[model samples]
Target chain A: MSVLDKIYEKAKANPQKVAFPEAENEKMMQAAYETGKEGYIKPILVGDSTRIKELIAERGYEESVFEIIDIAEESYKNDVVARYVALPHTMLKEKAIGRRMENPLYYAMAMQAVGDADVTFAGIDNTTGDVLLAGQMIIGLKEGISTVSSIGLCDIPGFEGSEGQLLAVGDSAVCTNPTPEQLADIAISACDTVKGLLDWEPRCAMVCYSTLGSGQGELIDKVKEALAIANEKRPDLDIDGEFQLDAAIVPAVAAKKVNRESKVAGKANVLIWPDLNVGNTAVKLIQQFGHADAYGPMLQGFNSIVCDCSRGAPVSEIKGNVVISAVRAMGQK
Target chain B: MERKELEAQIIKMVAQCYNADEAKLSVDSVFGEDISGTSVMMVGLVSEIENELDAMIQLSDAAACKTIGDLVDKVEEEL
Candidate 1:
């Protein structure tokens, strides 16, 4: 099965409440409809209730197939505001709370924070910053996680390093230039996500411009330090790095480059890039030139399961994200 | 580090973060209002400060700070 197919199977079996804050968008609404129809998730659409109902009717879909949360409704607004006020010393104070409640995305997140929803899938009509800020201020980060990072699940044909065709490339959509500690956190977050969604023992390669002690520079040092920190923090996982892309995924390169025998040397399924520029560029290059399919820019390190879809993503991509987000929510449960 | 030294470092960091002049960024300069710090910039600032002080600063505490001095005070408190 494809990774998404497996995730769809798992999600369909134990469906979770996944909220789509950009429910007003045509693509998002259609994806939500499909997600609910396939039993992959129970989609909660957060937008104008009447308009959403009209759209459902217009689209020939059952209104009961999706639950709509209208932020404009006085009662629902009051409930979200009340929930925001009740959180233990919430960061969203009076001024922030007023501003946040006006945005449906934050309201949707507030619902997740208060257990009214399970997960939030958004960013269709909003910037990544908006989605991330709402998530951080409302749902907050998981315990001991100080930073929020993202991972792109790449399915590259002819890429034989990983167990399947999938590889997790991280800090692609966040963390422009991560410090060593933050890089370590990104690795751990990616590992947790891979294990949860794909059910694989993540072998991470902290990719950089250098491989082992082959080169020396500030960038290489940063990757090396990150590797040490990740190793010290999680001894159970197989992770190594300061590896060049070739050394990371090709067994021949791994055998020639370093003396130490490493499980993740050539078999790394999770490639933690040194910076956002490198990660983002590499993934896009692969997608364009190599004809690989990249599934996510999945937000990680949050206490709750929240995923962001590119604003230009199609209905199929949105549906895939809902299933992936549902699978993550199931893992969390 | 002395409080003044730490304060200087923070002003420089915040100024760099906002792409403003260091001389204009006083200790009382609010991060979001006076200095224009975004959530992404805040994360970078927290990392920079932590590395400088060799101490952990809670993001919640940092987010609560209204000014550079408030951040310095939190760092002092942590120390």
Candidate 2:
């Protein structure tokens, strides 16, 4: 079966009330139909209803399967803007009023805030910055969460019908140049996310251009400091840093190259990038050039749910993202 | 070096990294030009300038530096 089928099966069996904030697109309609048909989610659609109906008819999608929320008629977008304006605090209402962009992410976030939906995913039709700003402004960041991160589930097929193992790579999407504190939070948060998915404990490797303290600078120091902080906070977490790809993943190479005697040195499942450029570029390289299948740029460390998908994502990709987002909102991932 | 000289040096460094026509690569020359540098190459250019010039610049600053002229101007200010 395909990945979507697997996710669908999982969702069908799950008792959680999953919700998807749909757009005026075919992919969302497809997922809504499939999820609703399977009783996997009480799908929520938010967009231009006429466009959605046209697309649904064009795709032969069943309209009876999902609940559609049209913003133009009900002025749902205006309602959210109004609510933000009515807030007693002057600073917040002013800040909300200043956001001139009529992005749908704000509406989606408002849905989550009011318990109208359990989770929301959008970034296919909007820029990453727009989606993030809406979430930050409306839902706010989680407590003790100073920054946001995007982790990808890298699932590559192994040789001879072996079960494919997943690798979590992160801070590659949102943060351009994270501070030491932010890096530490990224590592810890990524580890927590990974622990929810896999049976294995997280062995985080703070990937760098240079391996194992060979490079000395603010960037390297940042990783080192974050590593120390991560180790200190989660003493049981197996996390190491300032290591290159080979040193982090290859047993013999790590043993020969680095002297750090830790569980994360050779077999790190979660790899944190030094910066967004490196992290984003490296993940794309692994996905496209290395022929690895990537699942997310799953936005974490937010109080409300918002996941970003590639602009060229397929139905399966959207479904998988929805599942992950739902699980994250439910505090499972 | 004078501010103009520093800007010129920054442009020269960027041109060398980018392998573009030095004259065409003025402070105002746009990055990602068809005959100019790609975002990837521009990143290298930024790194090279940083290391050689011993100056600190955020990637955001480098990204927002639209033209070679704009880049040199930034280099001058940062330096």
Q: Which candidate leads in DockQ? A: 1
DockQ (C-alpha) of model 1?
A: 0.06
Per residue, candidate 1 scores C-alpha lDDT tens digits across A176-247 of: 878788899899999999888888889999998888788999989999998899899888888888789888
**Highest TM-score among the candidates is held by which one?**
1
lDDT of 1: 0.83
Show model 2 residue runs off by greater than 4 Å. A1-8, A15-22, A48-59, A70-103, A158-164, A209-215, A233-236, A258-260, A331-333, B1-79
lDDT per residue for candidate 2 within B18-45, as digits (tens), equals 7876786566676766235333345456
lDDT of 2 by residue, A157-243 (tens): 551111235678897777788877778878888887766544347889998867876778877888898888878877878888789
TM-score of each: 0.80, 0.67
**Predicted structure with the largest lDDT when compared to the true one:** 1
The per-model DockQ list reads: 0.06, 0.02
